[model samples]
Target chain A: MDLAAVVVYEILYTIAFLALISAGLAVVFGMMRVVNLAHGEFVLLGGYAAIVSHNTLGINIFVSMLVVAPLAVAVFGVVAERLIIRFLYGRLINTMLATWGLSLAMIGAFTLIFGPTTTSIKAPIGGFAVGDYSLSGYTIFIIASAVGVVLLIFGVLKYTRAGLIARGAMQSADMASAFGYDTSKVYMVTFAAGSALSGLAGGVLAPLVGIGPTAGLLYIAKAFITVISGGASVVSGLIASSGFFGIVSQAVTFATNSVIGEIGLLVAAVILLRLLPTGISGRFFRDRL
Target chain B: MTLNRRQFVQGASAAGALATVPSVAMGADSIKFGSILDTSGIFEAYGKPMEKAHILALEEINAAGGLLGRKVEMIPYDTQSNMALYTQYARRMTRRDKVDVVHGGILSASREAIRPSLRKAKTLYFYNTTYEGGVCDRNVFCVGTTPAQQSAILVPEAIKRWGKKIYVLAADYNYGQITTNWIKFYAKQAGGEVIQADYFPLNVSDFGSTIAKIQKAKPDMICAVLVGAAHLSFYRQWAAAGMKKKIPIATTTMSSGNEHKILTPSEGDGIIVCQSFSPQADFPSNKAFLAAWKKRFGHTNDIHEIAASSYDGVRLWAEGVKKAGTLDRMKVIEALESGIGYTGPTGKVTIDGKTHHVTHDMHLIEVKNQTLTIAKSYSQIPPSDTQRVCNLEKNPNDTKQYEIKI
Candidate 1:
């Protein structure tokens, strides 16, 4: 209702959004040891897809996610694996190069298709009014959906057969293959799922943020910051790092200007990363690493 | 990574050999004009259209009995929207291609990068886009509105029309920061105060926090300096936040009619844009220009404000060449410095001989429904001799304002 509440609301919403994106990237890097630079493009594709579906087909923004989110990530994952990523197994530099190339190509292709313009997807539920402080329905949905996804992923990886195989492959790919685990299929499925998570983040955030061709650059940096800050255990670490960064960014912006806020957060991120190479949460997941 | 003597010698020899070639020789053929554009990257929306306009202008110029009794030849290179590539391309154009004059650079950074090269090459450069000015080079002619031309005029009018409380939102780049500074300075001069100022990177998409801040500030009007497709996003988000009706939006860059092509009608409606060119200008030259552009591009309703300026740049350059009766860079520069006025599509174009900056009519346009209609036009604003004043001083940042004798 007041200024402080509004600032708090902004800080929380931003944290939730950032955490959702960073979670998928953290998983891919922490669990699979693949940087997946094209991860941001998957999000971009989802955002664009949401825009198209909403504008062209006149579908409900929330429902369009069902078609766009999974499809974008799956398409990227399949194509990436088939053309470039499959060869990058166990080679970090090669993986980085391949994914970086894929990122540039996708950015170029999307810009050509979408005309470098920023387009918006409508909020599914508009806004929920509470006294003088109104929260966007889309933001609420994003927060809820991201929480749901984090839980779902936690459940799948903790209690499921496929996730166990993924964990095994992540630990030692050669050993997992020697033990009759289909490491190739595991890699494909993990990449696809990671990409799908990114897409879901994009789809949900599309209404809240405008979709543009080069919009992924900042997010990619932010996601990396989250991943590195979170350390090796992808989900929880990334969530915590995202929250931390989001709060810092909001606080700085509130204190001064947005530009200074961004610069300050980035500088802080660099210093923190340097001091804690394994990251803030890396100590908790030492056994996993 | 160290180079051996033999390798260094070979590289030096190649460079020397390349330098010996005469770039601007008259071969009883077409006169070559160099163009550097961002065919790829974030600025492509502005760059591609500009390239198209340049080509179209060259075509029309050639068709109408070429400049200097020779058909005009355009040698265009894509910078890919990188500053390094822009410098490289500018060098290649002047040294390798031997273009008589150079035109292009949608972003101010690109133009700034190529300035030293332009001075060294002694090539006449026609900068054809709106910019934050304070630059005055003998070799360069700025064909776009300087901060004085756009913001100086817009801020006062905006403050008068929509109270004195203002919010300034700009892109976090050279153009944006400089323009915002100019706006702030002039807003204070006009007895208005900037309640808040914020900036976003060129590619920023989310405006929720920024809009929230603007709402809290409750400024009478918001002055935006965003460029390209990003404006569409800002407009939609601002409207969605319910601040569009509460605060009147005034922008130096975003209110251009070209934005309407990308944004929905509702998103663009009621925003006042201060610019040199508007698609709704009812001049005879503009009518002919629009018709020709539509015919060539086969796009009926998507002429950006920059297109007319670019077209005017080429036309003005050609006129200078004709008047000078030579392709000599110095001669062309002298002719352009004559402060000659030309009737073009956007309106009467006048270059300040002293500033090398073009001063023209500034249009205040409002988007009504879907079409950009001219709400008002401020014409004959005397071009400030800031360049002349600054040229005499060592530091351009000196707190001195040139008095207009008019």
Candidate 2:
């Protein structure tokens, strides 16, 4: 019974892990249609912000991770959107190339500033025992934060006026502009919000992993896989695909090892995409926000 | 003759190309020392310190006097932690630069990639990092401590202190695979058994499920051969789960990149490790090396096991050149094979003639409060693992790296 409970907890943690890493990319690529090749670098910037602020400037770890990291990276997003992303919006191939170059530049800049070695801070929380096993208390915090972030995104998009304008703009920018909504301004704000979400994910995960200049490369593929597998509906697709991939990967991990577990995830994503053509939410949750 | 625009351009380009042939043909008075390492990517934690060691050794040698009465010219190429660059730069160093001796390659794959080219080019090579054993080639000299020198001492000691059942977690590559086999061999030799051996790809960072599985297995001790920044999380996650106190831990690759400093005390404390060198040893040579390093680099914290070996590698090669009294490749190899010894940062390092590998000291260490505490030291341990399969004295033409099977 204790073993079963531990497995379930691991499966849920995996789901939360996928959902958190994919949230920002879902907004940027799924909603905004930007195909941000620099999304991983944005996440890395958030991690660095948290580490630098906490270790050097003596900021509280929580405030540094949750508040300063997102705010600082969001401002960087605004500048990046204004300078480069705005020019290549309609051209898909150009956006990919430009953002790819931007990613390289960010890695170089980070190496210059922080050096190439890995740096990290200690996890704020400790472990608590459950039956025969002790689990990291930080894992529970990550799972809860992932749920809260998803609901917040849903609430804003479903209920607020900015959410309505953003949705309408995404559906038909010409029509929304004709209604005097300033669609370009809407895009700018939306991109900033997406960047903020990625920053938050990075900040939250910094303690659990090592932070380095190339650390961004580690998560970019996993995030892209989860976001693409999630399909067009930001929240529901993310939840469904995260649930599916997380369960498959963790179950395999329990059975075998991490290498095969990761392989299981990639295999499931390929099969799911081949079967549904779009994604899980594309077929099932067709109208979900 | 009046030339057309295309003919004129072609003639000018041909002249430009023909003008650069003299430098390659005419050898300079200085002996070129070619170095290739990954100084700026994910592997920089290891590569950067090794590069610094090379420079320091060269400066010290030149300060005393040039090797073979000629100045040593360093020709460095940064591979940027990419494997493809290894071949490209190796070719350039041998064919274009025509260096006299080459020294670099951090990973085993990188060493294998360029070993053949250097051997064919007749340029002497020195690989200076602790790695899995069983590399046999007469053209190359491996100066790092091999698995036998380390795990042979570490495993039995850990088993006696802890218990018989061991769990092995290793990075999933040639290094990790071979090292895990060595651990198993040593464990069995000590009348112990390995309960489970898990291999993780170098990039797999999450260890929650692995930790839970380990708790369930409940081994007497955990042997971690995990590598790189990503694998460092295993220690953090293990500690976060409160398993550090429950089970004793032993490692073979922890402080190779100075990971003990990167990890907090709560995460890294109480883990036992064995390696060829550490900055905290109590030897006079080690103290002098640390003082010299502080004087030159302004800090002594970055001097890890491999960096010390790298510095020793350069000085040992210089000793060979001095003994040979010539820059000829065969003469220098013969000199090195004559069993030249040096007392460097690591105590009493000497070249084993038959295996073309080094014999050096290994230490047992424990991490506490982000510093290594040296508990015990074993002097002049040999590359016995490689020596078993490789004997250059018997078969000088042997170029095959025998994969040792248990």
Candidate 3:
């Protein structure tokens, strides 16, 4: 393939990956009102688990992810809720400190256990060619799987009885409980689902990006920016912001240097966020809030 | 009763006299050696093994009856790969721990960061890592090859082989910027011109756009100075982009012991890495070093260029101390400045007393089937001070001249 086509294909694939991460973060925040600083660690855990399984058991990448993704997120959800996150339900300051500490501790623990080295997973499906343009089969799979997940989530929330109860609980916990809803169970399940989404995203992304202990630091900042810009509402705001930010950043990097591109995007985002206190999509959710 | 008192006084005097006898028996004492390194962080892959090598060298020397008949006690501290922590640990080693000599540092930034503390404490700092060198300090003895030693040999050979319309891709940091400058200078000297230059952040994963620009530039060869796993990512993406056949890639700083393990054999093939040491270099010293290393570490993991250099640094310091017949810091410094050659794992290394830089053989290696094969070895390159415009020999203690060439 020619160079231009290759660049376009890579940028699209990266955007789709970012959108999945942002959507996962948006769901948890929207329901629980908890800022999960340890979210990136969970992603790293899933990636490492997949890498270990691939190297040791000789399992295919997709098969490994099927086992790793749900287990990582479930473990993280239970530990986070029981040990620390429970105390920070209403206190933002407490949540910030506890989660930030959790993030650092996780980084240290992983480095000690795994050593500071980069690990990779082989692409499950190889590349395919269409005319003069070549595309990675794994990249296409990532895009399709993410879309399917989003659609599945949208359906569950819109049509299922459990989905209605979840929406009601997020809007008003006391009112939902007064209406005979099991708010605690709903909260637990929502947190687990959000964590699971992050794990799934990491598993799919292991081949595209190599996993390192400190790799989570880079993604966490961008994910937080996407979540804040999207107004921490339903997954729609997240999907929109992820696409917008990813494309802008990639295009700017193509036009100039990556450092300059990052600076420009971050500066613009910060200014827009300051001007709009609630966020870019805040106006749409004003009546609901 | 009076007789008993007199006997007691005489006995106490005799005991005091015996206590001072050992001091006279042993006139001098052994010197202490301290090392500060990142034991757990991003750079630990380089630093941890380096610490192990230092300890091994110390054990070998002390087993041979110590330096100047004084046992060498090594005290090592983990810097955790943080710059602030490096300074704190370095100071604590010199002032509180009172080590007579110091060694160890992996990153050029970390080395530069700890310089002030090394100076203020007046402890002799033996920097063991290869760096972008122009530094000359009374307290600092650089044992690794500078950019001049590395690039002066590599660039000319590259230009001789490929008509040098060169392209530069580097990490956006001090080491990358300065090393790229050295390449540009040497490339120009060899009647070649650089067509394009680009810098990327340290953690960049995607090289699709950067590779596109490189392809558009259409240079005869590209010189890259990226380090760590980032190099692996860049190589995979570049190869997948199909730029490998069109452009030949070479790097002075990218190849290290740790990097080879991370990248698959196929991904790293055909890339040329110029370095001070290669595991495949045909030297008896290197063969022994590798054997001992594998036996102890339980794998054939290639020791990093800096780790061997650091190991050599400890041995050289021991030799200097032995030759000087004293543990006095100034005497050891004077001995090191006497232009002596030491047989080391890399090869025979000669220290330039005037420049305070070590000159040695450099190897050009190509990655083939997951193994580093030697392409060629350049035995001699001018010391860094001679290549630069300034005369560093006139003032060995001058700090300003260190930045000019580096």
The alpha-carbon deviation from the true structure for residue A210 of candidate 3, after best TM-score superposition, in angstroms, is 1.3
Q: How big is the positional error of residue B123 in model 1, measured in Å on the Cα after superposition?
A: 2.7
Native-to-model Cα distance after best TM-score fit, residue A45 in candidate 1, in Å: 1.7
TM-score of every model versus the real structure? 0.88, 0.95, 0.89
What is the full ranking by lDDT, best candidate first?
2, 1, 3
Which pairs in model 1 have colliding backbones? B23-B98
Q: State which candidate, 2 or 3, has the greater lDDT.
A: 2
**Docking quality band of candidate 3, CAPRI definitions:** acceptable
The candidate, 1 or 3, that scores higher on DockQ is: 3
Candidate ranking (TM-score, best to worst): 2, 3, 1
lDDT of 3 by residue, B9-126 (tens): 9989899778766543553365678888887778878887788889879888888888777788788888887888887788777766677888987777777877778777778888
Per-model fnat list: 0.16, 0.75, 0.29
- Please identify model 1 stretches exceeding 4 Å from their true place: A124-135, A159-161, A168-181, A267-277, A284-289, B1-26, B228-233, B255-257, B300-302, B328-331, B385-406
Error of 1 at B72 (Å): 2.4
> Predicted candidate 1: what Cα RMSD to the true structure?
4.5
Q: Which of candidates 1 and 2 reaches a greater lDDT? A: 2
lDDT of 3 by residue, A1-289 (tens): 4766766765776567677666567777755778888778877777887878778888776777756765676678777777887766879888888988998998888888787788776566655554444445666787786786677677878889888888889888999999998887788788887777777777777766777888887677777888788774565666666667767777787788777768866976788689876766685554332
Lowest summed lDDT over 10 consecutive residues: which window, candidate 2 chain A? A210-219
Off by over 4 Å in 2: B1-27
| DockQ of every candidate structure | 0.32, 0.73, 0.40
